[model samples]
Target chain A: MVDDAVQRFCQQDLQLREALGAVIFGQPDAVDGATCALLAGGHLLLVGVPGTGKTKLAESLADSTGLSRGRIQFTPDLLPADILGGETLLPGSSGDRVEFRPGPVFTQLLIADEINRGTPRTQSALLEAMQEYSVTISSHRHRLDPLFSVIATRNPIEMEGTYPLPEAQRDRFLLEVQLHSPAPEVLTRIAAATTIETQMTATKVLEPKQIESMRQTVRRVIAADSVIDRAAHWVAATRPEDPTAPEPVRRGLRLGAGARALQALILSGKVEALRNGRTHLDDEDWKKWRHEVIRHRLVYSLEGELDGLGPEEIVSAVDRAVAHQG
Target chain B: MPASDSQISSRSRRRTPTGLRVPRLEPRLRAGRARILRHCSRRGAASGIAIGLPLATIIWLTDHDPGRAAFTAIGVGLLLATVFASRQRRRAATLWPRIWDRIIGSQSLIETILDRQQQPAGNPWLDALRARSAHLPLPSPTALRRHLPAPDPRPSLALTATAMLIGAVLGPFDPIPEVQLNQDSGSTSVAQISSELPTDEQLRSRQQRIRGREDAALALAGRPALEPLARQIRGLSPATTAPQSLLPRDLQAVQAALQRLAAGDPIIPEVALWNPLLALDSRSPMVTSAALPGDGASLALSTDPGNEAVTRSTALADGGSDRPTDLSPTPFDPQLSAAPIDSIQLAGTATDDASDLRLDTSVVTPPGEESAASWDRVRDDPQLAPRWSRVIDLYQLWIRGKEGSGGG
Candidate 1:
């Protein structure tokens, strides 16, 4: 019965992805990645230049899911309370009462645009809400919706005044989807679509209840032991201290992802398998989702930075090492 | 989300052979694995033949020592074939997963089935999976073979056969007649030396010397007590005394007579003509008569006492003037015969053919030259004497009794 529901949800989610793709022209991979993170109940970090449709993709994602959406334009001066909500004094009938004003994080989908523009303290405020789906403000626990997903964006070009997200905060996001400029043909199609006077609104492809149900079904999607083993082995090989790590990884890595990385791999792998209409997961999905899962979590060493090596190289090394196992 | 007991039991009731109803896919998987191994084995065999045949053929064509070439070819063929087969087998073993994927017609279904097989505890998800997969058709051996790529046989067979044919036909060839001609041409008219029986004059001179030694022996004996042995020695016909044809008994008699004379006086050694050609070369011992220009030269012979007097006087001076000289007239004194045989041998060439060369070790010399220039020609000849003498040593008997013997 659960497999049947997951299959139905997979079809619905693919339709939602198609709807988002129509709004975000020429970014099919980004749209699919965003849809996967949203349906899997995990946050996404979009990295790209200023006008590559990162915010537009997030907005389209909200519209297609029909989830209540909130936006916070993070700046250098932004405070933790500005994102997580703060207590305000309100006058009651007989005495003054302290009430909490819910922040933008209290929604189904929250978009933190230019998240690197905010200080590390303010950026870390969303870690709890992104990971636990709840915010703790002044001893008061406010639970966000179970279907909440934070879609954060950062402009890679303009970095003069912005504060980059710390590794701890970056690790909360399940995927860091990179957005690129569209090809000439796609750019032309985008120009044609924008010049027309007709207003385009994304149709609601999934409801909040359906998303919650899909998350449950995603959990039930069978991850075969070998697929889990493959993901675990790859994640283990990412650590420089791990015996299975290849030499390149040992040379360049300072900090490796923790068990959360493995969870993200298996979860994303399950989502990919279900999307492919397979009841059981396989290493193919794990390979497809590895870079997105590991890219944000890896902390490179000083030499690695000097050598201009990035997480993508180490992730590729880990992948090649695991591929040769047996 | 988990399957309930009712769902599992109900699915079990409707099991089909295509899916969950098949008790084990291990058998099919094992069979598929074996088929791939067999394919790899066949490929490895083809590779060995392709590589080994050409290599062996090249070796066979280039090797000059045909005695060892066949064995060398077989050894190299087996070594190359074994190395190639081992490498190919390793390559083929790594393709097992790909083979599994190809045979099952699905990407991860086999991994799923194998993963399920690893779990000892019952799994509701696995059961559900099996039930869902039950509707899909199982892969048969025929289907697997149909899915496999076709075998290739072009370059291996053609290249190996061509190499073998070329090695067999166009390899090195030399005929026996050409080899023989090369050997004969290499030996063309190089100077050759030959030895024969002594000439009549040389034999006569040798008999005269032996007679003189017998008379000296009788003198040393102090009486005619040695007369019988001297008579036996004189009975040797000087006209027909062929030293080459002397019997062992006649030599023993002469040796006994010399030993009796030596018993009377220890100064006497065995008397033999150590060199005939050099003895015949002196002016008085040989009378040279120049014949007509076309005919060979005529020569007369005699033993010269004048040369003997000169040789004896030289020996007496070397013995020191303080001691009185004994006029024993022994041709070979034990003291005079103390040097090695080759030091006293007159330089002469011996024949290479044993049939033409008769060596009388008792009196060693080469005789019977057609002319004086012929004797000179035999002495100056370089390639003939040292080489032939190494095989047939004629002067060894000059020192036969005395360990350090030489001429007077």
Candidate 2:
């Protein structure tokens, strides 16, 4: 028995997904992941090879959600101040006053492209804004928009001159959407659609305020103890030291998902339930999105890398082990 | 009004206080839980009975009374089934909501309702959820049965039936009693008859008897080569003459000795004939004698040589009496001729009739004829083989020759 409010929210969510899908061809998972991340009111981390429409997905997410979008092309020389604006002394009629200039992160949706290209020191600049939704510069605190969300993209193939995100920074992201290459048929459609004189753009489907309302509704969605227990079990299974951890996790991981990962899983699962027009969180809702919410938060050991144990494999193993326990 | 705004406003109205009416789904939830518990208990009881029947059959086969054992087994099975059902019911009570949710295909609606019941009221989401699930069907009995199917009792039932059938066919039977043989008794004293191994003393006694018989046979042959055996026989202890001491081989040896003695000389010593005859007659108390065929003289063979009646019979035969005396005594006692015979009157019959009161001794058959008649009766009997038959014939001839000499 879905509520009328949740039913309407589901309708808007469907529209938003359709608009994103129209803009970004053949990446329904990416579109859904991006939509769920926004609705969950958490940041997204897009990981794929270049030209897989990672940036397009981010832009489409912003466009479809009707959030003000800003783009930043991360470079090796970029500084923390470039991401979080600093206070500067401006010329005035009487006395020069230090005025704070908000950076691209201040926008509702900030697209940080090739985020790994930035140095670790510069890439960490968005952490405070992403987590606390506030930035501190020169002993002054600046609050970001309530709808502020960072949609960051990283090119997995471009390893040279790129600093990998530290565990702390990666933990701040709610989900990591991996965009795979389009199939041959999808590629033809992409090419035909993109080569047109007029470029296709995502139509706005949800206002920023409506998304906020939906976020509130997502919070109101019932999460029974059973769902929380399953989430706890899955999170516990990721740790190498946990009794429930599988052999793969114990052998292939140095660090596993933490409480934040559990929070992100349940939060995103709530939004997923609302999108499915349910007022309660289900095991399937969380299970379907577990990899996205937990994969990037895991830190693989040297042995794991040598054994070709990717985060996907580790997370999937933990999921299987936890599911088997249930 | 745009359809989208109208729909949004309508949804907004659902969040108001008026729309916060939580449906009464608890009764249905409780009913579903009870139904699941009942199903679980029934299945548990079925399983218990399936396991219990076979164990009871085993008890019955162990010599316990069939009716009592079967009743006790069924009682224990029911008791265990009750205990197991209680446990299953407890477990099912806790797990029913989740199971129901799974059955109804609701996304944890029943569980959410249950969880929400524990919290403070007035949650619109819970109310809306209840409203949504108000019309959701409780799992039917058919569905419950499908999910918690009864345990298959075929294998256990088959085993129990086979065991019961076996128990019926082979009813209660006594176990074999352990018998401890006496180490001291040279025989099984507790048993009326036993085929146990002979003790050391018994074996030694049988061996000595066999040796004595062998020496006697060699000596009676009267050959110069057998003189050493004859001397050995003269040196043996007289205790070897005990009839009970003779085994089957010893008896055969003694018979051969008598045959050899008769072949060497027609006359046999009286003592030699008496000793072997005593050994042969150990299992039977009767001693038989016959008169010479044409001399009209009789001989009486008796273990008690002092019996006057036998002496008188022998004297009469020596007197050349044509009528032979009855040497056959009553078969019950070999000494019946020497002892006075007593007769008891039948309780309900007349006591005054002299014919009924007195013993009939007037009708006498000659000993030779009686002996011939007895031989004819038993000559072809299985126990008397040709060898034994020949031994008896020899014994009768010796008796006749002894009688003929006495008459001369």
Q: How high is the CA lDDT of each candidate model? A: 0.66, 0.71
Q: Give the C-alpha interface root-mean-square deviation per candidate.
A: 2.1, 1.7
Give the per-residue lDDT digits (tens) of candidate 1, residues B101-207: 66665667666765565343355666776664545445555664575543355665677678778767876644333234443465432212112547687777666
Across residues A49-146, which tens digit of lDDT does each residue of candidate 1 receive? Answer: 97689998998888988899999999989999889889999999999999899989999899999999998889999889987789988877889987
Q: After superposition, which runs of candidate 1 have C-alpha atoms over 4 Å from their true positions?
A: A1-7, A188-199, A310-316, B1-98, B117-125, B132-408
Give model 1's DockQ, 2 decimals.
Answer: 0.23
For each of the candidates, what fraction of the native contacts does it recover? 0.32, 0.65
Give the CA lDDT, 0 to 100, for residue A85 in model 2: 84
For candidate 1, give fnat to 2 decimals. 0.32
Best by lDDT: 2
TM-score of each: 0.55, 0.65
Residue A54 accuracy (lDDT) in model 1: 97
Docking class of 2: acceptable
Worst 10 residues of 2 chain B by lDDT: B343-352
Error at A233, model 2, angstroms: 1.2
Backbone clash pairs in model 1 (N, Cα, C under 3 Å; residues 3+ apart or in different chains), count: 5
Model 1, position B397, has a per-residue lDDT of 37
Runs in model 2 deviating more than 4 A are B1-25, B132-134, B161-408
